[model samples]
Target: MPSLDDQPAASDLHHAVLAWYDMHARDLPWRRPEASAWSVMVSEFMLQQTPVARVLPVHEAWLERWPTPADLAAEPTGEAVRAWGRLGYPRRALRLHAAAVAITEQHDGVVPDSYDDLIALPGVGDYTAAAIASFAYGRRHVVLDTNVRRVFARAVAGVEFPATAVTRAERDLATGLLPDEEATAATWAVAVMELGALVCTASSPRCGACPIADVCRWRLAGHPAYDGPPRKAQAWAGTDRQCRGRLMAVLRESEGPVHASALAAAWDDAVQRERCLVGLIDDALVVRVGPESYALP
Candidate 1:
């Protein structure tokens, strides 16, 4: 593990990054003070492996239709799937709906403020629990998303990219760098994330614009290319995921159950289409309404 003493002073990095965030952070609705805890939770779920620009409109519509956890929980789970639109990962929609039901039933329609309570909810993992606690409730906790991890890897560990999965060393580094004060730590967490998203991006980072560029160990050591195990790009075309998506689109478009023939027409390969349909049914993203029909569940 890299010694915490070896990294740049937390205060200096916090000041620079927080100041930059105050001036340049995107005016996202979820970040607004008026945003409810439910809003933050919704944004967290939608923003997973998805970009902000793509989430904006869908988020707005989602909140407009189902402003509270109770509202979402009251509707059919299938409705949630329908509203998910072309977000690619439809399972997230199912998970979000399940979370809403759990929150409405257990949390009194309120998103929990504590990490323990939040994590107990369906679909809320460790990172999501920490994020909801920190960002939504202004609690002191380490919020280590992919962006934050990358920022830490470069600025503290002098690495071009972090390991495929977060390491225990990385967690310790983040915990050490965290500000003691609750509110400051919350802002610092998001500030680092914003910096990573806007400046220290994965493909092409804008080092000149980065606030902590001067002290970044990666830059100080001369920016090196990632030489770890080969990173595989996500395949989309003709994959099971793509086939599932096409089948889902047909289900989402129809108000009533779609006949098996319609779903067959959506995809070319009959065997692959059948496989995707069965998988979707097993996932509960699609329900077998009839012998020859399917619908969003």
Candidate 2:
């Protein structure tokens, strides 16, 4: 097994993966030089647990309507939720709206460049803060998303998957592998993430196409299967999430508030429908305007 302490091997891995990225990186609008910091921030929010193809059109429409943080902030929160358009997690829209309001009010309508400032925004966590700073501002920071984590698990630790939650050890490994120069480190972070997304995918990793296949510990170790605690499976049908989506879809399509009967027609289970409606209200994704009438908020 190659040691993590081996600087020469680490450098080789970096160079090989980065060279591969240079050749194959997707020309995402958010990654382009012309993309604003707001554009990158929006992409990050929309991309969470959502596929790129699904997010692309919505992202384009969103930017077209509200080109800046101030523009989004000027609109009603309900407008934000309506614009979200079946992204699954509606709360992300609320949080994104809140973050936009913050950026407009606190940062003069500009996405903050500093990690601390970015992290201070609503819904911005460690990984997000680091990613926005590095990817948007070209700042050097350790940006470990799921793909990056899985790549590290297989290539460096010889594990099929990482722990369900990130550990201190994983953070340290990412930090250690970050390039010294700011620009190089920034590019390296996204490069590794791209490699993971394109080649080292979760279910069907293309190890044969990987740049560091020669040094991949998991491949060298015979591609052992993951034996960690069972990963959470996402259930859709009959779930509250689906119920919520159906109800939200009704509200989104309607120009005015929908009656309780309209919402009841969307989902058959009266109890689950009512429960999810209340939950959405509590989550501030929905608002009640009249007796038994609901609308996006």
Query: TM-scores for all candidates?
Result: 0.97, 0.96
Candidate 1: segments with Cα more than 4 A from true spot: 1-6
RMSD of candidates 1 onward, in order: 2.3, 1.8
lDDT of 1: 0.92
Q: Kindly report which residue pairs in candidate 2 clash with one another.
A: none
TM-score of 2: 0.96
Candidate 2, run of 10 with poorest lDDT:
1-10
Local distance difference test, each candidate:
0.92, 0.91
- How well does candidate 2 score on lDDT at residue 88? 66
Pairs in steric clash, model 1: none
Model 2, 125-189: lDDT tens digits are 98889999999999999999999999999988888999999999999998898999999999999
For candidate 2, the lDDT comes to 0.91
Worst 10 residues of 1 by lDDT: 1-10
Best candidate according to TM-score: 1
Tens digits of per-residue lDDT for model 1, 249-285:
9999998999989998899999999998899989999
